[model samples]
Target chain A: MGNIPSGINTPEILVDVEKLERNIARVAQRVSSQGLKLRPHAKTHKMLEVADRQLTAGAAGLTVATVGEALNFALHGVPKLFIAYPLWINESQAERILELMKRAKLSIGTDSVAAVQQMAKMLGEKAPKVKLMIEIDSGHHRSGVAPAQAVEIADAARDAGLRVHGVFTFPGHSYAPNAIDEAVNQEHKALAEAACLLRKAGHQVKRISGGSTPTAELSDNSVLTEVRPGVYVFGDAQQFELGRTGWNDIALSVASTVISRHEGSADIPRRIVVDAGSKVLGSDRPAWASGYGRVMECPEASITALSEHHATIDWPEERELPGYGEQLRIIPNHVCVAVNLVDSVLAIHPDGAVERWDVNARGLNY
Target chain B: MGNIPSGINTPEILVDVEKLERNIARVAQRVSSQGLKLRPHAKTHKMLEVADRQLTAGAAGLTVATVGEALNFALHGVPKLFIAYPLWINESQAERILELMKRAKLSIGTDSVAAVQQMAKMLGEKAPKVKLMIEIDSGHHRSGVAPAQAVEIADAARDAGLRVHGVFTFPGHSYAPNAIDEAVNQEHKALAEAACLLRKAGHQVKRISGGSTPTAELSDNSVLTEVRPGVYVFGDAQQFELGRTGWNDIALSVASTVISRHEGSADIPRRIVVDAGSKVLGSDRPAWASGYGRVMECPEASITALSEHHATIDWPEERELPGYGEQLRIIPNHVCVAVNLVDSVLAIHPDGAVERWDVNARGLNY
Candidate 1:
């Protein structure tokens, strides 16, 4: 709505610092008031600045998806970190994790006995240095052992001389439309059952972790000691479509220019093509998602198609179409994947000065 | 499948050198024999080594999607470069283009008269230093003027003292099932009509560039002076699904490890989760695509879903599922986007030696 900042190139991510802080504070406050630990997933922003904001808002620690991400945070002196993924740790990765443990309290997730045994074999005597969280399959069914199998994995970790700290699950199925309540319920039941099983098996299950952005607000604190919600820091189109966050709450957007515009005729609809496409905005359109992404200015407009560097937006008939070279802010379908595509994001500070935040863990998928 | 090489981590791209060379050679021979110059799009691999191979294989130049990509190749001493996207150049970009033109012959695509006028004003006396290509909409309609509007934009560029190179159109509609022939026809007709209109308007149209991976093999060389195909070097699942490439033709794949596996029960279907997800393989699934990606070793296996770092694969019933820590090669839905996701790719040489090829133009989307 305002002037697109000069010197900021098209198809670049711009983080609204004010909105980001609000998003952070709001979630932190909610989690804290509910008496649950907030360990915001660093995979979303991957920026030290965003992690700092979350930490400053009283996050217990940072949850990472890979050892590379964990090392990125730990090297920056983040005191506590967790790799919340069932990692099949290789010899080289084991060495990195050992080095990482020296800087921070590192923990990783494991769902299988073989993975734990391999982690132990790779880490050897240093296995106890890294704690393990047995992943539980709530209902999302992507990864994690069944609730009954939590004891088996915990026993395997214990037999491998690793510390079984707790259990964790990712209620990713909550992302679908009208599935939030079911996902929350399953997450609660799974974590509760897994914790009970581990306790009965003579293991101290102190930490129970679960929560995606859609199910974060409705997390059962009675079962979950902490929640890891990454996308809450920068709401995406998925969260918006799932009615988790409103348009005003979306903090991250791609600043792109209209490169081409076609006024509608009787046969074809009016549309404007923007420079930002899957390369910058990402192509993570779920079946429930409205489009590839959303136009911040025109909420009803749908980005019907996207090429590598071109997004074709079906312009609403009632509104005047933007001309060539006109800049528009676009909310990506998935902020995490979009953020991972670029080296850095332009963070617009509260004072209107733009600062570059390096995506320190940009492509650290391994 | 052979052993997954040591030292290479999971969820990483592996480019088979022998297959890559063969793929490159085949395409080069086909295009050269047709009497059309080959300008391979660097957006596919984005590796200088791959570009060098393409150049050595008789490619006339490299076509890029952005000014940054053009600069990347130019700095690496690539003799000729073309930014084939309709760029809305700002002052900063104009400065970069001027600097870029000093190192190599540069041409850019423009669909609007306003864009050409702005280019002229931005470059001023140096406008002629760069060439302009009028992009015609050949039914894809993402960006580009209609065939009839080519003369208007060409006239604007010519009046502004810019050299009108020719007309180019991307037949992106060729990416669908049973649509390759129609796309080729539309591309030929559109380019021919646009070239005719431009010639009648007293402009020397030397180059008529058009061709995507799907339509490249069937391109009408009589009307096309040069053809640009990005994904021919490294076939992806999309190309495989479109019947444009066979499984053996795919030169690039993501080396992923199975982190979790589940056998089918009465209700739930069997699936395995790999480390390669949207963050690595990229989430570029068209509705017509079978799945998120494909397992190279198991062609029938479908990557049913993808999280940021987990790909849930639906393994075939006949095949024995890969165990945890077992590595698998995964072909992404789109090779270009997958290549852009990482900083480097592991190029498996003909001698079986692995080399790291830096994606020098990885995130040069701006």
Candidate 2:
């Protein structure tokens, strides 16, 4: 796997080794200079190697979305993990969570009093109690209780004998370009208000966590102790659209081959079909995305549409079309989902050697 | 692993062993009765065990969407694998294809003359003499040459010394209700016309294949020698919405736990958040789909929207709401993409025994 050449593989994920290292170094340096904890979210690159790079670069901990993700990272010896999503604790899953806790310091998020009570019942007589973070709905009307109702849930969690660690919120609205500043400000206010309420209720509120990739840039570290920005480690289309990262900073691309071609008549420009399709690049065209995906070398050529095994592209008439059977590289709109869509990524080393790394956590969605 | 109880585990994916076996048996019987080869597309299950079951049940061959899928199936000793995608063959990939042909009977689809010529150049003396299938566009407006133009490509494939096996098309439009009849009819017409054109050109057409799960039941098998249907084994929300299959026929579901319960307001109607998000279930909401996803047991409930790590459901106030930490099963809109998003599936046996089968081809999209 390590001896293979990077450009030879078809429908393979290509991670620009240099760009990835630079992105990790930049994020780690920024967070460290601010005297804040950097818990890079594993939801973006659910790979142990990426997590190892972050930890080696001085990340305080790792942030994961599922108990399975936490377990994967913990098995690889990542000491501190935060299951950032509000977890549903059942009798069966509780046993898995307990096992994860035995390996690493675990903190889980919850937004309901019933969930806290359920966890308490499941964790009855356990040596170390699971740390709980109350999720507050800052601006994103998705999961999480309202900031005004945060105290009630915190009180309930504390009463259930679960250690109420702090309040956390995801400013998901920040993903939108115009909403970043507003979302971050709202997150600051929501976390501050929730912490004040929890403190007034006699609960020790230590950590105030909030920040997604879009919001992390503008987030006020003065209020929050930690930031979890997953996509920052591998800038994607969303980052490019939001102006969070430049086009050259994108580290991942899908290497595909031109399978079909229809030369331009007087009416239609040259149309080339690439083998990379929804299954390879992932059919994630956000409403705001320009196209299905963008071409790395030929940025002007947009991936107009995607079928199960075909990416339709309209090449400009002035530029010579890539001959059929020619290999082309594509930079996906959303790298996180694209990475999840492939089994392994071709890691191009600085010395021009290619190593294939199995996305060990590729499909551990459960 | 088979000794464990299925219900005790979390509800991400539930395998009804009886229903799965019944599905395989029913499809096999139908194909056998029609005197057509049954090459079940492994894209739906992506599991080696399921592929083995289909083959053991007397499947003639296996169908896959990518070279990686073909390689994975070939590794499991599933000989005679057809890569149903019109692959873009480059020099580097041609070598790999030649390598793959050594282990299995490799057949690939092509819609362009340039690709065929490229394969001819790369294959050289040790070309493995791959079988080529011409793809015809039957109103899907996706890949494949038009029905009228497929013969030209077929002649090119033959001229290049490749075996022109058959013509194939995907009736992707059959995914909507009242669309299957028209789509399948178009498929029949397209394949017939393509076959006739090839025969007129003094070429032997051994097969005429086309059938997706949506139109598999209604497909006209008189003109076709074989039919490929992937999702019939695991009916999903799309099948239910299109009226292709009833809810009772659905054999796969995502098991999720109610992690958050919004219990404060009567107007809210007890909203519960599950861990299944777009990443897990896939953000596939077809225009005809009822919602993002459907609750497996509570068919009336709808998954209104999905965040990265949360599924927001609006529960009915008339009935008792699912308690926090209560487990619920969800059927995704598209099962093929959903199954590919996970690493392994828990196979629940008839007597309630659970066995985990690695989705050996889960993300082998390359």
Candidate 3:
């Protein structure tokens, strides 16, 4: 896509149409050719247009992080959705899921036997059948049960009158540098083990799915039937730093104006302050991740720190820093977090026309 | 207020009426007794009801961070407003500010002579007189000009036919563990010096304001004519750790459900995973902050880490960890950010009635 004009609002997410289409097609082709289903995560973009494009590009379904996101997509006529979170089925959520099941084929992740039993009780007799996936631990140490324990939860869901649809896990450790290979290995082993255990327990394991953006290339397609990657459509600074992608693959960036430029000593590193801060880019600096974000134009320049509404950048000494009112595109460390910060984004098409796309599922954590 | 009913929603902000009233009255009394104007930052709650309470409690005006926030407050019938950020005055922002001035008395912050000149150009012929304040650097080193240079911009604004309204600064560096005293001293020195310079330049300094939540109590009221402290209304983990607030002063928290509880090994601490994550609490962990947020029921229990939709809490060994489906209140690291994360908050009244209050200016980042 062409460069964004300065007429629109600053500190806004800008989608480059050409790069987005290419990124969508690329991931879709790779996953489809490997005989694996492409179910791109809706938590990344959450825009109906982007979801339409992914579905049109051979995605089998959409993966969401919350029930509200699933509802948002279902309302827009997405046929299939999987809420890939170990969610607590509260009364309101269970009732909403019952309504959502009428619109789309609903699948949810469950890590506990107690939650599955509660969901079953809430669903009662008249509810439609819903698929359940056991969340298996893939060495992320965040959530999910051990691979050996996955069959127990899957069995519990099946016993409670829910359809068991196999297992899934997140390779969250892959976000760090030098950890992609290890995370990929963990994903393959955990998924394979979970599938084997579930099948032995008399459950028909149809969908054994696990894949993050960085580990997708090394994913064991032989055992997996589906791949879910969110950030591949919008390559962030974290992915770029891990050598998972280059600048050309970046489809989305935050367009920020240089509100103030600071003169600094050598120790401080000459800097410029942009309007985009933690409120826009998000405060998600993993200890292993360097800087806040990478500048799209000059990857050498790093967003050193962030206040509420100001991003302080440590510019390179070799080049001149931007002046007041100069706009720059910033690739945030986490695209999922950055996309949630704004209500809508300015899409700069290849032909230079701009359109707005609302983040329909933003702030839908409940 | 009573404990949040489990029937509402998870990862939602809950406001306690009893504590909220106390916090508001306490700040209003302290600022009024000291002969300083209490214009608490509206960027914290962004709710009209909270602004109404603050105004009724004895606030002179409301302080906002952006033009959008200013307009939001103005439309809510707040008589006076101040945009306490060195904002870039684009044509659209200028038009909005001009429209807002018709509804309320408005003032804006400016740091650079270039920006002030540009503002004068866009706001030239037909616009009414708007107050302009020069932002003085009070050791934050983020935005604002030097204390000595404040007079130059104040003079330029005056020459450009705008009403010159003194100087202000933010002690943002006060968020660290032991830096409150130094930051308070810096705020006093900078605001006092800037006022003196403006007076020396034959300009009347009506509003010499500077105070963050941490430094609000330690401010030298003799030097400050007004103070703007946002997070005081909803005390957060950062304030509680810095000894700026007591546990009783915390009026707002996120109600999250324990989705899964994990048994730990030697390296992994005993943990419970909550549904409230960075998307709800916001990812604003300062290096000095102990954890992502604090458990309201057990302040010692720290949120060890966070995913996009899950807060992993490492509970204290001595205390019992919450099991699945337990609803717990979470005090985030930064209240300002957490407030911006949600569209509406569940306000628990003194009579134990819970009502929804819309965050009117949630994403007014522009």
**Model 2 Cα lDDT, one tens digit per residue, A1-366:** 112253475777888777888899998888777767888898888888788899999988999888888889999999999988776666677888889988999888888877777778877866236678899888676788877788888878767777888889998877775877888889999999899888988988889898788877666568898889998877876678778988888888888877777664564446788878777777666667777888876878877777666788988767888876577888777777888887678888778867777777766665
Candidate 1 wrong stretches, greater than 4 Å: A1-3, B1-3
What tens digits encode model 3's per-residue C-alpha lDDT throughout B1-366? 359766877888999978988999998898788878898998999999999999999899999988888889888899999888777878877788789988998788888887888888888863327778888878877778777887778777777777787789989889888898888888898888888888998999988898779887676568998899999998888899999989888999989899888777786567889898999998888788899989988878878889989998888888887878999999988998898989999999888888999999998887
The CAPRI category of model 1 is: medium
- What does TM-score give for chain A of every model? 0.98, 0.95, 0.97
> Can you list each candidate's DockQ?
0.79, 0.47, 0.66
The number of clashing residue pairs in model 3 is 0
Candidate achieving higher DockQ, 1 or 3 = 1
lDDT string for model 1 (B325-364, tens) is: 8989999999999999999988888777888899999999
Q: For model 1, how big is the iRMS in angstroms? A: 1.1
Best by TM-score: 1
Among the numbered candidates, top lDDT falls to: 1
Better of 1 and 2 by lDDT: 1
Q: Cα deviation of B75 in candidate 1 (Å)?
A: 1.1
Could you give candidate 3's per-residue lDDT for residues A1-366 as a string of tens digits? 469676766788899988999999988888877878888899989899899999999999999999899999999999999999887787788788888988999888888888788778888763327778888878887788888888778777877887887789998978887888888888888989989988888988988888679877566468888889999998888888899877798988888888877677544347888888888888888887778987888878877789878888888878887878788988888999999989999888888888989999999886
Q: Candidate 1 residues A1-366, lDDT tens each?
A: 233568778888999898999999999999888889999999999999999999999999999999999999999989999999999988888888889988999889999999999999999888998879999988887898789988988888888799999999999888898998989999999999999988999999989998778888887578899999999999999899889988889999999999999996686668999999899999989887889999999999999998889999999999999988888999999999999999998888877788888999999988
Model 3 iRMSD vs. native: 1.5
Worst 10 residues of 1 chain A by lDDT: A1-10
